[model samples]
Target: MVNIGSLVGAGGPNRGQASYATSKVAIASITTVMAMELADHDIRCNVIHPGAIDTPILAAFADESEDESSERTIDGVGLQIDT
Candidate 1:
C-alpha cells in the first residue's frame, strides 16, 4: 500500500494549518501501522512525504502570482530524497 503525506506532517504544526498537518500525520501513522500489521502477509506499506511543489495548492497560499510563487518556492528550497 502507498500513502501520500506531506513535509508538514514531519515538520510539525504550521501557523494556520493545524487541520491539514494533522490529516497528513494520520496518513503517516496509518501507513506505519499497516506496514507492521501487514508484514506477516507480505504486504508492504509506505508513505511519501513530498515537499511543496508547483501546484494550485501552493498558489492558494502565495502572496504573488502563481507562477512567481511556484518559481520562488521551488528555487528557494532544496529538498532531496533518496529513493
Candidate 2:
C-alpha cells in the first residue's frame, strides 16, 4: 500500500525552504514514479493523508481551561507559531 496523499503538507514550517519542500514533494513524486514503473507488473499505488489527527504537538495545547485550550493548537503551541 502507498500513501501518496500522505505527502501532503509533510513540509512543515512552510517558510519557503527549497530543500524542505523538495524533500516532502519527493514523497509524492517518488510514489508516482514508483507506481508507474510497477504498473506494468500489475501493481497498484495509493495514498492516504490523515490531516490533523491527534498528535503530540496538538496534545501540548490541551489545558484545564477549555476556553484557553480552544485558543491553542498543536502548530500554535509554546510561543504561538502561527499569527
Candidate 3:
C-alpha cells in the first residue's frame, strides 16, 4: 500500500488546518500498522510526505514563481519507511 501524506502531519503546523493534519497523521499511523501486520504476507506499505509542489492545485491558491516552486519541491523531504 502506498499513502500520500503531508509534512504537517509529521510535525509542521498550519493554522486552521488541524483537522487536515490530524487526518494525515492518522493515515501515517495506519500505514505503519498495515506494514507491520502485512509483513508476514510479503506485502509492503509505505507513506510519502510531500511538500509544496508546482502543481495546478497549488497554483490556484498561491502565486509562486517557477523558481520558488522548484526550490520548495527540491527541498521537500524524501521517501521514508520503517519496518
**Steric overlap count per candidate:** 0, 1, 0
Instruction: Give the lowest summed-lDDT range of ten residues in model 2.
Output: 74-83
User: TM-score ranking from best to worst?
Assistant: 1, 3, 2
Best by lDDT: 1
Best-to-worst order by lDDT is: 1, 3, 2
Question: Across residues 12-54, which tens digit of lDDT does each residue of candidate 3 receive?
Answer: 5555468988998998899999999999999999999877565
Give the lDDT of residue 72 in candidate 3.
Answer: 50
**Residue pairs whose backbone atoms clash in candidate 3:** none
Candidate 2 vs candidate 3: the lDDT winner is 3
Candidate 1 lDDT tens digits, 29-74: 9999999999999999999887776566555555343466444544
Q: Write the per-residue lDDT of candidate 2 for residues 21-83, one digit (tens) a residue.
A: 576567767777888999999898755544544555545544322564345433343343332
lDDT (Cα, 0-100) at 61 in candidate 2 = 42
lDDT of 1: 0.71
Clashing pairs in 1: none
8, model 2: CA deviation in Å?
A: 3.6
